[model samples]
Target: MPSRSAAGVDRRTFLRYTSAIGVTTAITTGLTACGGPASNGDGAKGSGGSGAGTIEAGLSYALSTGFDPMITSGATPYAANMHIFEGLVDLDPATLVARPTLATEMPKKINATTYRATLRKGATFHDGSAVTAEDVVFSFERVLDPKNASLMAQFVPFIDTVKAVDTGTVEFKLKSPFALFPSRISVVRIVPKKIVEKDVKGFDAEPVGSGPYKFVSAVREDKIVMTKHDKYNGPHPAKAQKMVWRLMSDPSARVSALKSGRVQAIEDVPYIDVKGITGENKVESVQSFGLLFLMFNCKDERFEDKRVRQALHYALDTEKIIETALLGNAAPATGYVPATHPDYRKASTVYSHDLAKAKKLLAEAGAKDLSFTLMLTDTGWVKDVAPLIKESWAAIGVDATLDIAKSAAQYAKVDKGDFHALAAPGDPSVFGNDVDLLMRWFYYGFWPEKRYGWAGSAAYKKTKSLLDQAAGLTDEAKRKELWGQVTDLVADEAALYPVLHRKLPTGWTTDALTGFKPLPTTGLSFIDVGRA
Candidate 1:
């Protein structure tokens, strides 16, 4: 195991990474939740549930967690706060539409270097301050600041600058002819300029937003409570006055809470619990964009060889992970980057579970007694399946020690390139349907640390060159043509690999809530809910 800088990503791999690609620009609307027959609302009025008064929902996330979305990292916890915070625009889960939130509509493209956006009418922050062009510009600037340590900064730094032109409009300038601007806008979740200015420390204290819900109170590590803001000016009615977000850490405990009627909703249901519940016996079965995978550190000397990489790829059993580990709730996949996104590349130059090929490649590479520490963290999927993988690899003469990292340590390790191989999940956005992000993350020669997995591969230089050519091609036909070639090259040589994947599932008692659609990326949509 070596750091990204220590692993040798040569110039060749860098060229290939730059020239490689897959592009996606849009997302899908989520699933719909209709009240169930076992519903607790008891036809109260909406959903036949008595009436919408106070909705008590249980989230596996602890409250009092910091307001830093990028810091939190994981999909479940990040999504909990995402429900309350909003940005310049919002993705409508039902229609796969991007609607104006703080801003009224899409930004106007001025030229290859700049674009301008018009603000929405009468949008105000929860703190009584009017949200205007200034706030939008400030929000983007804050995230881009290196000191802020926003994980989002890695993606947004491409833009040269963001500025306000007038009262209702703002402008953005990019260094190059970047086209995925809208997709980037979708993730830069807006924060109130007033709140951060007042006290950066108190940001977690009910940060103001124009969303339908307002932060009420929260206890660190336990739960966060949000009440419906009366001043919310949206098309829908917010049924529940108080949204009690309970932070239950245990997955089984979350299930128990749902069964006992303690919490109305929970996300990230362990795949093991899916069959016992859902009943098909009438609860809504939520199929989300939940993607799970094993990450290889190309920074490691052992993984530098392409044959070794391919051998490792073919040794695992994805179908078994889906059936035995996930129980048919997910799809066995290979590189569904920007998972479930509308424009992601589907036809793979890189998908095969060929064990024989894997064995042959290992022998060819002279990788005798191949072994490394395979780091995994505690979770339903990993806990159940990491052992199976260890055994699978062992049978293939590759010994792997299952080293599990604690939550905090795990986050630190991956971000710092501290391990050889680890199990990590990525819910990434590709503002453009092209492969800039795909290539930069996996194959960039200059930033081995940034290249998702191939940071230390010997072929990095060549990969980066290919990526530059792919990105520079403004011609649509040739760009796609070059992208196809890039895809073929990486499918054979790169380090980013997908193991087993499952659909993210959320549990909600139909009695107290309505309009709960589960998104693949984020956990739940708060604005869409109403007193049912």
Candidate 2:
């Protein structure tokens, strides 16, 4: 089978494709534990026990997108889907380890290019419909359909077809022998066929799934409410009777909400407020693959030269940026993936802070007195780092005008090929933890093809070839070797590369919640968490 390409998709499709998989942004807050059942301004009661009370959380991202697991890219909705949907296999909220959720166990290998899984008996969707082989087959089919243009399609390009072998068993045929097939399929969450076909738009607005929680209601930029799926017969059942997720994008509001005991937990704890929150609550910062990357428009003459790109990367005082801006909560990008990742391998080309090297590279590329508008998203964290970035570039004789705006606006300029360079936060690790998935998110798909204008470059072709080779290999060591090579190539090219990987800081009241843990990814998860 030939490798999939994004060549034929139109401009509108390209925009939707990029927007549907918009990068997950970082958020932060602080919480104080309440001694008993906590009551919100609305008189909603929250506490911990089986089917006992509500679990109120102050989420950072607004409802920018819908709830469909197939295409929803907004961090808050994606996190909400964790409670409302499940794949044949689902990753543990805390550890990110793939485990059997709707399936009886992990998909069993039938051959080099085929695998089969049996549904867990008695598992039913939140709407009281039994989850069957048809549902699983339909779920994968919609995502695999090119006409549907699912963002998830890019991740599972190896899949040839999916069929229901029986009412309870589903089979998958891959075009190539993929070693990570079991865990990789976790990207496509299973949804009921009849309801989706009847009303996809309605389904997108309000989702239904076989997880521990059922979608109740969602108001954009306000709150999302859900009730426990009492019929859920899965391993991780909802511990709280109800859940109220208050969408508080303002860091101060989230902090105040948590501190006042209106919410039990909050994520994306502000780096500056970490110390203050730590004195009264449990604040844990987990190093994640989430990163602030610098992307160059390879189509632009000034940035088309790889040396110019490399020079810009070398110019940044990453240590100072992390120390002053992030409060030392991030690590400089040594590789495409974070050092904490299991499959992480040091890239051959590590860009250390060297002003002299940066200047030399600029001169070699004939980019003397370089001036460009550095576009960036107005995410709170990104805004904090914006001036520092300009200062770093200024030291190397580069006049960088910072153009800061919301993610949508900045990305609009990027999508139209109207921008020079952009520094933005992205975390694709929320989908899966494998190196292939992580690297492919930025390097392989619509990102390089449309957003960054590297699709026509020889380096992009080389990176694609290496990734495709790695995907087809069954041998673990050989696959990783190929991945390492791709990592080194991208790092050296520096077309669109990570500047630093951030530590996802989360704050929660220790005595207010049980079985709660911080995620390394962008969103919060309450899979097995309960209010106390």
Candidate 3:
């Protein structure tokens, strides 16, 4: 089981809460003024003079998890880790292309199942400890250790062993040949073995990594702060002296923060405000793999039949949800991956809104008078669409009781197999953009095995086999072909499938920040961004 805070929500339930405290802090703190100074007594001092000033930005998600990269799944903390941590290889925050971080370059292939990487010379952690090969091995080992229940463990299942070949060199031996090994290893960030072993809990709260920024302090549903790591010698050095990420879950608060010049950037820009904000700031709605999905509890007898699952999917008027709730900012999901994805291939079964078809499927499955409580997270946009979802199902004579709550509470129920159906947002593209990585995020690992209760089914076995087969193939066409098959299979089954692939709208000021680019996935990245 994944670790949860006292609030019973795992880090994975990112963007799940709208805290009154966050709104109150935004209002009472007087963040409305132009060019407000950094928080009083923030203690963020750095040697990066002149051009480097504090970069204040507004983040939409509350801090629901710790900073530990191995276990964190919260969107805000994950974005914070991007500035605070580094992998042997890391995805470019804006483009998601894998690039060498601690490693000299991408890991060099030694054999079919072996790869080697040498640490960058003079690379040191935030605490000034030298980044060593042993630390790299320790990082991967901890994630691979099943007892740890790392959220990232499912991303790197091919690895068999990782060992320090020398003081500066680390080697990996895979259980099988995996073509994406070099880039895939980006999922595991290197951590100091000595520090982590001494105090894992403290380390999770205040993580120490070799990235360009160092963690400072964080207040749940309030704010998170970081300072530039002056000692960093990596490719993307922190250009700003310090950073303050305000946890503003309210959409209007984020908009007000950006418009009032309190924040240089803000993510998850409410679609309704796009036109209004674009006149004053830079707003871009990039097509992303982030999606609102419909998931069923397969263990529930009413949903055991594939027809029942498909019927629920067919009942959704996804286009209406996109237009009414999202204000034309999202697309109906055509496949497992968004149609904008490079490896996208349309699933054979496309459930365009058909009330009659939904009725027929329910009847065929002997599921008449189908009634179940539909659970959902109270994300701003998700709340706007929840009633529409119920209305759609009602049209097919299926009564749906909407159970809307915070993300943590909902996922707590989900992980315990206590729900009939769930509609929530997910985006694995934050980790990587490849089809294999995205598909495996939901279908292959903890998801099918634990959350959805589909692990023992024959379809689950076949889906896993196809993903494994795709992972090993070096031929691009063959891998894509296999992925397409898996997409079609999952789409037809409709066990856990995306309802719509939403666009990620981000707002930033051109004059206040330089070298800033909106990420296509969830969360904002300020890796190379500097205060103007």
Superposed Cα deviation of residue 56, candidate 3 (Å): 0.6
Prediction 2 global C-alpha lDDT: 0.82
lDDT of 1 by residue, 316-425 (tens): 77677667876777765544443454434543645467778888988998889888888776554666778778876776789998887544456456656677777644
Could you list the CA RMSD of all candidates, in the order they appear?
8.8, 5.9, 5.8
TM per candidate comes to 0.81, 0.92, 0.90
| Model 1 TM-score (2 dp) | 0.81
Q: Model 3: which ten-residue window has the lowest total lDDT? A: 18-27
What are the clashing pairs of model 2? Answer: 27-268, 28-268, 28-269, 29-269, 48-531
Stretches of candidate 1 exceeding 4 Å from the true structure: 1-52, 63-65, 68-77, 93-97, 234-239, 278-289, 338-341, 346-351, 411-418, 429-447, 450-453, 456-486
Count the clashes in each prediction: 55, 5, 1
Specify the highest-TM-score model's number. Answer: 2
- Native-to-model Cα distance after best TM-score fit, residue 375 in candidate 1, in Å: 1.2
For model 2, residues 1-532, the per-residue Cα lDDT tens digits are 0001111122244346535434222121221111113223342445556755778898887766567788766677778999999999999878889999999899999999999999999999877889999999999998988767686888899999999999999999999888899998999999999988987766777688999988877877788877788889989998887788998888888888778888888988899888887545788999987888999999999999999999999999999999999999999999999888889999999999999999999999999889999987777878899999999999999999999976667777787999999998877777788999888888986789988899998888999999888888888899999999999999999998999998988988887778889988776888888767
Q: How many clashing pairs in candidate 1?
A: 55
lDDT of 1 at 210: 62
